[model samples]
Target: MTIESVLSNNRIIAATQLKDIKRADESQCCAMILMNGKLSELMHMPMVHKPLFIHMDLLKGLKNDKEGIAFLKEFINPTGIVTTKGNLIEAAKKEGLLTIQRIFLIDTNSLKTAIQNIKDYRPDAIEVMPGIAPKIVKALKQELDIPIILAGLITTKEDVLHAFEAGAEAVSLSNQLLWNGTTEAITTK
Candidate 1:
C-alpha cells in the first residue's frame, strides 16, 4: 500500500480525470482522471465537477517542455499525483508541482529501494501496494517521514480498516472486487 492509506481519511477523493466520471459515491471516494486522456473528454463525466488528480505519467511525457508546463499550469490546477522517476520529479517540482511516486508493489527488496528513493526526492508522498500489511506500513512510516498512500488491490471496507489499522493514511482502489463508487469508503479510523 502507498500514501493513499494515510491521506484518505473517511472522506478521501481518488482524484481522476477520466472523460467518463462514473457516478460519484460521495461518502468517501477519489476524483481521478487519465493524464494522457483528453481533459475535455472528462466534461462528459457526470461528476466532472469533482476534484480530480492527474497522473504522473502524463506529466513525465511533457517533462521540461515549456508548452507542456504551461498547459499543466493552466489546465490541471487541482492536486495531482504522478508516478515518475527522480529527474522527472525534480522537473515537476521546479514547475511548482509536488508529485507522489507510484510504487506498484512492495516486496522486501523493492520496499527498501522505494523507501530510499522517496527519501532522496522527499516527494509530496509515497504510494505502496499489493495488499501491504499494516505492520509493514508502520515500519515504512517510521523509516520514512513521507506519508504512505496504499494503492492496488484494495477491495473492501475491511481492506480499508485493515490498511488504517496497518498504519496507512490513504488508499487507492481500482476494480479490485471493491465497490466502484467513490462514496463506498469505510468510516476508517
Candidate 2:
C-alpha cells in the first residue's frame, strides 16, 4: 500500500523500538516505523497486523547493501524502509520495498543537497526530522510532491498539530503515549 494511504486517517506512525512492537501493533497509529534493532532481532520478529517500515540505518549487523535489502524482504517482509542513505533507498526500492528517505534539516545547503539527492534517489516518501520546524516543513511541502513525514523531537500534541498545519502527511514518534491518540490532531485538508 502507499505510504499516503497507510497514514491517511490517524496520521500518527509509531516509531517503535523492537521491544515495543506489540504496543505499536495495538495502538491507534496507522502504521509503524521499526527504528532500531539487531539483525538477529529482526530474524525472530513477530508478525504484526499493521504496515511495518524498518529503519535500515539503525539496524545493527545489516550490511546496508543490496544483499541486506534482499534479506529483509525475505525475512521480516516489511512494507518499507526508512533510511538517510540514498543508496539504501535505491536498494530497497529495487527489492520492491516502499522507501522513505530521512532528511535532516541542518542548514540551507544541506536542504538543497537533500532535495537534489531525493530527486536522484526517488524514494516513495520523505521524512523530515525535527518535526517542530513548521516553516521548513511548509517550504519542503511547497517544493516536493511526494508524501512528507515529520519525525524527531516531536514531543507533544502541540508539536504534532504544528507539523500537520505545516503540511506533514504524518508524524512518526517513538512516544508510546502519543501513539494511542493522545495527540488528537487531525491533518488539515
Candidate 3:
C-alpha cells in the first residue's frame, strides 16, 4: 500500500530518538520512527499495533547492504525502514518493504541532490529534516510525487499545522505531547 494510505489518518508519527521503549509504548501515535534502538533491543521490544519504521543509521548489527536488508526483512520484519542512503532504499524496495528516504536540507545544493536522488531511487516517501522550513517543504511538495514527512525540531501545535499547510503529508517529532495535543487539529484538516 502507499505511504499516503498508511499515514492518511495519522498526522503525527512518534520519532523515538532514544531507546525509550516505555515512551514509545506510551505514545498515542499510530506510526513510529525508531531513531535509536539496537538490534537486540528492537527484536525484544513488545510490538505495538502501529507501523514501525526503523532508522538504519542507529540500528546496529546490520551492514546497510543487501545482506543487512535481507536480515531486516527476514528477522526484524519492520513495516518499513528509514535511511538517508539511496542504495538502502532500493534494497528495501526489492525486499518488499516500504521506504522513507530521509533528506537533510542544509542548502540549495542538498535540496537539488535530494531531488535527483528521489528521481533515481523512487522511494515510497521522504522525510525532510528541520521541519520548520515551510518554503522548502512547499518547494519539495511541488516537485516530488511521493508523500513528504516533515521531521525534526517540531515541538508545538503550530509547527505541526504549518508543516501540513506547507504540504507535508505528515510530521514526525520526538515530543510525545505533540502527538496527543495535535491530533484534533490534524484530524480536522
Candidate 4:
C-alpha cells in the first residue's frame, strides 16, 4: 500500500520482537515494520523499506548515549522517549527528535506532572494507554496541537479503525502480534 493510504487500509506496522527482530524485519513478507534496539543486524535490509521506532529507555540506557543518539539521528529518531523524568522531552526537542511521552500507566501525580511537560517540552505526539478514549482524545487534541497515538490492548482491524475514528491519528500494534509485513491484515484483495 502507498504511504498516503488512510490509517486504516489496515495500516499494519509490525512491532519488533526482542530476539526475532532480525529475522522478522528481514522477512520479505513484511513491508512495513518498526524495530527497537541495535540496527547492526538489519544492515542487509533496504533502508527505505525498514523503518525503526525505538523505546526511550533503551536509547537512554546506552553505554555511550551520545554516540548512540548521534547514530540514531541518521535513521528514525526515537518515536518518543518514555520517561518519568519529562526533562528528557526537552532534551529530545533540543536534539531535534520527535517524541512520544508514555504516561497513563503511571500514577495520577505523575500523569499530572506530565501535563506540564507537554506544555514545556512540546512533543510531536502524546500517547495514551489501553486504547484511546474519545473524551480523553478530544481533551488532548484540544489541549495540545500534537497528534495522539494509542497504545496497549489495541488488537484487530476493528480496534485499529475505531481508534482513528475516535480521534487518535494512529494506534500502535499490539506487542503480542506483529504483522510480518504481509497484506493479510491490509484487507486488500
Cα misplacement distance, residue 134 of candidate 1 (Å): 3.4
Model 3 score (lDDT) = 0.83
Among residues 3 or more apart in sequence or in different chains, the pairs in candidate 3 whose N, CA or C atoms overlap within 3 Å are none
- Candidate number with greatest lDDT: 2
Candidate 3 residue-wise lDDT, 9-60, digit = tens: 6678888754564576576675888887677776677766678888997788
Task: List TM-score per model, in order.
Answer: 0.71, 0.94, 0.92, 0.63
The C-alpha stretches of model 1 lying farther than 4 A from their native spots are 1-11, 15-17, 25-27, 30-49, 58-70, 175-189
True-structure Cα RMSD, model 3: 2.0
Q: Give the candidates in order of TM-score, highest first.
A: 2, 3, 1, 4
For residue 55, give model 1's deviation from the true position in Å: 1.4
Two-way TM-score contest, 2 vs 3, winner = 2
In candidate 2 the C-alpha lDDT for residue 143 amounts to 72
Report the lDDT tens digits of candidate 2 across residue range 1-189: 777778776889999999999989999999999988998888888889999999999999889899989999988899999999998998888888999999998899989988899889999999998787867876776777898889999988788888877778888898787897733544332
Against the true structure, candidate 1 has what lDDT? 0.57
- Ranking of predictions according to lDDT: 2, 3, 1, 4
lDDT of 4 by residue, 65-144 (tens): 54455555554453334433366656655666555666573455755665777787666666677563444676566667
What are the runs in model 4 whose C-alpha is more than 4 Å off?
1-12, 18-48, 59-68, 71-85, 105-111, 132-134, 175-189
